[model samples]
Target chain A: MALEQGDELPELSVTPDKYLTVRYAGASGDYNPIHIDEEFAKAVGLPSRILHGLYGMALVARAATEAGGGPASLARLGVQFRGMGLPEQEITVSGTVADAGEAVTTVHLEARQGENAIIREGVAELRR
Target chain B: MALSTDAVGTSYPPVLYAVGREKVREYALAVGETDPLHLDHEAARAAGYADLVAPPMFTVVYSAPAIGPALFDPVVGIDFARMVHGGQAFSWGPLVVAGDEVTTTVTVKSIEEKKGLGFFVFESVSANQEGHTVCVGTWTNIVRGL
Candidate 1:
């Protein structure tokens, strides 16, 4: 089903774990130890090996894009990383269309771990 | 060791990074962004974009790479590898379409040290081949004492 304006997607969840961390590092060439190795992360004062903010944003974007339509549909995808998403908490991603025109659609996205949003004020623009 | 506030005015010249369709697609895939505008050139043209435009944040990776040397320069005092990416913000100007040759200039905005914690901000402005500003981003990194 094509997502129209004011549409909200079903809940999708992701957990930040070691395997996902490795894939993110390999894919993006961002091998910051704070994201992959716990000992190194602790040495630097992080609570634990944490998920890359972009990785979480990717999950949210994936849902928004899929729901909106397909690859050639999006015109813009923007997100601001708010709080750290940890391995222990499972984050749920969802979106609502903010506006729509004849051939264009805008989506508002958010990823929450429990009630707290780790990503805030995300938007995706898609062409219909 | 802490970041030098004096580093604020340093400017890093632009570097060429050929944007690959696969990279854009992979990034789109990784983020679960299936926007056809990012994957199909024809679809992008139909939508009024020249070619496959990327996710709004994609260019940051290329431009941020331009600051790699400054972030690691020993004289800069901060250990780039050990630092954490505290945050990032972007203000979009003109749209960044695919196949556009772009130049990015990076400058350090400020450095602050307090209570044994050091924070630094770096900003980059990316322009199209025609010198249109595509986006401006500020990245904050926080470092802890070793």
Candidate 2:
């Protein structure tokens, strides 16, 4: 697929199971109680155990890379955590080629849960 | 307690991580990555990789030990109970595959107050066994005020 400017990458959607956060915490070695212990999360002012911000970021990165080229083609991926991500809700990752340059291409991507943007300002740089 | 601005520029000891095939596969599966390059060695080799490729986000595991000090430093005083991930950025260099040894060095990039919250930034650089950079990551955290 030619990465022409304005070309849309195929959208990827994932619904993390209720225990996804726990699995992610273990897989990523980011055993923060706020991501696993519901009681601990509530005490800390969150509604409940929330997904690790990196989990959503990774999914978005994968979506961009899978479409742009592949893992090795990804030069950079950046994102800001704008909203809390709860498990059991469907999250969608979508993006468009923002700049198709001779040497590199940029993809403006985002991850959303319902109407909320969980990973905002998503940017991915792909090497041609 | 809030992280002190004085902690900015503090450098933590470098951490060495041995990239394992199973760990790489586990991380890819955990993130729901279905790419065979990250899951099958033969596919990775066919794709020009030496082994199963570690997805870009695997930097989280390889750099965590180096980043831990800044979040736990007493002088820095991060309020763990109220802290949350704010943002993340990564720039990749050489692709990381299984059997590689990665060493990550971390430094406190900044600490400041923004909108009554404490914002902390840490910069980490991971290098392959050959000393080629594998990834550069900027990690941000926000601590809500009392």
Candidate 3:
């Protein structure tokens, strides 16, 4: 779909499997213990291993690309980490086109896990 | 101890990344991406890309290594134990195709402490082998109870 003002990006709802952080760590080379080791995370005062914030942002990027029609259409992505995201819960990325210009369209994105907002003030620019 | 404000503007030598096809596939799978444009070479070619497409966030892989030096640099003095990923933003130029060699350079954009919290930001520029800018990334980290 050609995104225009007030268009909604395809909603992406993903539930991270138990090994998601482990797989993401290997693929992204971000082997931080807080994302992979449950024991280490609990030791550091977290409930358990937390999802990588980047993973959540990536989903936002994917949603924009999906709505923009292709990967090449995405020109920029910005996301803010507002709360911790745990595995096994539904994380949803949803957004609406805020401005549609001749050259670019701006999509305002937000991500959430239940009541917690994982990414707030998210934005994406797509070539129009 | 507080972060070293002087660390701002410290630049690191550029690092090069060979954008491998399989690695791109791994990342797409890890993120549970469904677009054939990113996963299937033929689909990407069908849609005008030269090869498998690298997701926009793939910039992280090329830029993370450079962030390491900035994170560990004594001049920056980040307390890793207390630091947490705060946010990320990227301005992309072109779609990164598999086999495109990308070079990333990072610099400490800012280090500031406010109300017992420390904020660190790094700016990175990634360019393709032909010297065209591929992406610019900004990474933010926050230290608690600083």
Candidate 4:
């Protein structure tokens, strides 16, 4: 089913812990220490071990692609990371149609972590 | 030593990056993007692109390392371990296909200090083998403790 203007995507959640951190490392080849070790993160002044920024963005991208119809349908996608996402905290990816037509639709996307928002804004363009 | 804000607008010497098909394929697969336009040059030409265009976001991985010397310049006093990504944006003109050799130039755009925290904006431009401007990327990093 293709998402239309004003259609809300089913909310997706993730609590990225050490295992997920390692998984993302294998998948993305981003070996940034702040994402994997608590000591490393604290040594750098982060509150705790954090998820990779791209991983969080990837979740939002996955949500948009799946909810808007699927992989072969997307056109343009863009995201900006705002705040750091820590481990064991739940991240929620959600979206609503920003605009749509018979052949294509644009969705406003977000990924939020509790009281702190990791990614406040994004746009996903998908086609039917 | 603290970095002097006087460095803004200075462009580093261009670094040549060899575009590898395998890297492009890995990125596309990781992103779950199976667009043939990003993989098969013949298909890409059929679709009207110059060749197998790399994904727009992939430039960051190739060009970011070129800025490391300045980012960690002893005079700069930035601790990569303490740095936090603030934001990033890309403005793409033409597509960068696989098998294209490109030159990348990175520059510091701005730095803002507030309450002992530092926010820095860095920009990178990637040009094609023929020196055509292909994409421009602006990324922000925040450093605490002024």
Candidate 5:
């Protein structure tokens, strides 16, 4: 793929569910109640069990990797958790090639669940 | 009590984790990844890897245990009940292949108190048995005031 600055990368949409969250909890070893127990989350003032922020970041990384050709192409990825991601919501990841260098390509990324921006200040660098 | 800034610069002992092919495949599937390199050993070998490769984020699975010391330190006084993940950053070096024995060391990078919340940064560096860096992950946690 010919990557260039100002080029928009393909968007990736992921709809997480309770089952996925449970599996992610087991896979990631992050058994935080806010992510696995709805009753605990509600008792703690959350609307419901929230998805792990790393999961959303992984989706963003997947978009970068897909656009860069493969997983090995991605060199760095960073994101700030801006808002909570609830299960069963379609989270959309979009990005633009911010800079394309001879050795690396930097892409600016964002992930949103509906109108709420769940991940902000996202950036990914891929080896060229 | 808020998290202590004194813990900054503390380093934990390296923890060893064996990356198995089945574990890698299970993580890839759980993350909704369908790439052949992560599931098929032959395909991965054809792609220049020794065996099934792990997804970039899979480092979190192996590195999570290394951070337990810092997160649960009594001196740091971190309240798990009020803490939330604030951010995450990763820099990859080499792909983690199946059967690779990885060692990770967790370090408390920084800690800051602001607006009644404690922001702590932890860095984990994972390297293969050959001492080649596999990945470095930085995790941020926010501990809200009670």
Candidate 6:
């Protein structure tokens, strides 16, 4: 794929299962109760046990890598958690090539759950 | 309790982590990454990586320990119960391959109290055994008042 500004990268969508949250907690060593305990999440005023923001960020990073060519191609990524991600909902990761230079390609990324944008102000730079 | 801005600029000693192929693969699986470069050693090598390539976000797995001291510091007065992950950012250097022993040094980048909320920022740098930087991560957390 020839890199160019405004080109949409391939979209990556994932539905995070309830069980996957537990697995991610164990794998990432981020055992925050809000991510694994539904009751705790409610007590904290959340709708439910929300997925870890990094989990969603990781998916976005993967999309960037896939778009840029490989894992080694990713050089920078940034995301701000705007909304909560509930388990079992489909989250879509998409991006557009913001800049295509000879040495790198910058991508403006976004992750959405249906109509709500869970991650905003997302950006990634990939080595060309 | 308000987080003390006085704790800003505190730095923690480096923590060592041994990067394993299985650990990387497990994280990739948990994140729903199906790329062969993250799971298969042969595929990784074919793709020009030394071994199974870790996802860029995989740095969080190894570097989380480095930020523990600041997050739990008694002086900081961070209420774990009220805290939530606010955001994350990353800058990568060389690719982290399996068998690389990395050390992460964490520092408290900033702390602020505003509008009945506390904001904390932590910066962590992970370097390989050869002293080459693997990644730099910035983690931000927001703590709400009870």
Q: What overall lDDT goes with each candidate model? A: 0.71, 0.90, 0.90, 0.71, 0.89, 0.89
What value does the interface RMSD of model 1 take?
Answer: 4.2
Mark the 10 consecutive residues where model 2 chain B has the least summed lDDT.
Answer: B1-10
RMSD of each: 5.1, 1.4, 1.2, 4.8, 1.3, 1.7
Candidate 4 CAPRI assessment class? acceptable
lDDT of 2 by residue, A56-104 (tens): 9999889988887788789999899999999999999999999999989
Residue-level lDDT tens digits of model 6 in B36-109: 98889999999888899888899998898888987898776788777878888999999999999999999889
Error of 5 at B57 (Å): 0.6
- Could you give candidate 2's per-residue lDDT for residues B83-106 as a string of tens digits? 778889999998999999999999
Q: Which ten residues in a row have the lowest lDDT in candidate 3 chain A?
A: A1-10
Candidate 3: residue A6 lDDT (0-100): 84
Quote the positional error of residue B82 for candidate 3 in Å.
1.4
Error of 1 at B58 (Å): 0.9
lDDT of 4 by residue, A70-105 (tens): 433556566778788877788898899988877768
- DockQ-better candidate, 2 vs 6: 2
Q: What is the lDDT of residue A18 in candidate 5?
A: 63
Best-to-worst order by DockQ is 3, 2, 6, 5, 4, 1
- DockQ, all models: 0.24, 0.86, 0.86, 0.26, 0.81, 0.84
The TM-score each candidate achieves on chain A is 0.89, 0.97, 0.97, 0.92, 0.97, 0.97
List ranges where model 2 is wrong by over 4 Å.
B1-3
Sequence-dependent TM-score of model 6: 0.94
Among all windows of 10 consecutive residues in model 2 chain A, the one with the lowest summed lDDT is A64-73
Docking tier of model 3: it is high
* DockQ computed for model 3 against the true two-chain complex using alpha carbons: 0.86
Candidate 4 Cα deviation (angstroms), residue B81: 4.4
Q: How many Å off is the CA of B121 in candidate 6?
A: 1.2
Clashing pairs in model 2, backbone N/Cα/C closer than 3 A: none
